[model samples]
Target: MATVIISALLFVFVLFACRSAWKRQRNGCCGNDIQRLKKVKIKGDKCRDYPYRSLLHIDGMTCQNCARKIENGLCSIEGVCATVRLDQKEALVRMKRPLPESLLCGAVAKAGYTVLKVDFLPQSGHRSL
Candidate 1:
């Protein structure tokens, strides 16, 4: 009987936590879902036809600071929105408009790294927005 009560309490706590998260999401600050979700790196918006996101390989990302530097550099760029996973050694970028592949190649180069590959993201029918 005690086990059942504890389990029920735990379940209710989880439910409340989820509701709090939902309410926070509802606030909707920064940008809309479209701009946030419907973004790709190389393809941008114009190439709605062939939007692509890249897993950029940064050759010299030796540590978290290195990865953070790359993330900061890329994110500072006007059109670039980047999420970097240091453990993965990848920078997932979404562009405001279809940017030239060379731009990524160049910026990363200026930041002191190497570009491995850029893969186009297929509309999983459930990307971005």
Candidate 2:
């Protein structure tokens, strides 16, 4: 009886832990930061400050490789750092400026894709962390 009770308690603990991990993953899973180099090719004194992390919604990416290409492509753009996550088919960008809608959408289009939409998220003073 004691053995069965201990086993059941362990199982319950594992179930709880799994649920917590699942919730965290839903928030943002398997994301890596893209760090830009310290210099830019543009003429002297014509540069933007370091980028800020921002999240955006991108549509039209279909697979893992497609997502990777999107990340690389977006990162290649001047003044932007991007991490593309395929699970949710979304691109999270850290950008020096609020990207022009045409700029981002057009790149994806040139890559033989289309951007269905983009949503901007503003920073808030509160973080539960």
- Choose the strongest candidate by lDDT: 1
All candidates: CA RMSD (Å): 13.4, 12.8
lDDT at 52, model 2: 45
Q: Lowest-scoring 10 consecutive residues by lDDT in candidate 2?
A: 31-40
TM-score of each: 0.52, 0.51
For candidate 1, give the lDDT: 0.62
Which stretches of model 2 miss by more than 4 angstroms?
Answer: 1-56, 123-129
Candidate 2 Cα deviation (angstroms), residue 101: 1.1
Model 2 Cα lDDT, one tens digit per residue, 7-126: 999999999999877865553332222232222233222222333445546666655546765766676677776666777777766566677867776666665566665766554232
Clashing pairs in 2: none
The sequence of per-residue lDDT tens digits that candidate 1 reaches over residues 1-129 is 999999999999999998776855663321123233332243243322224455576676655555655766676676666676767778876665567778877877776778787664543222652
> Global lDDT of each model?
0.62, 0.59
TM-score of 2: 0.51
lDDT of 1 at 76: 65
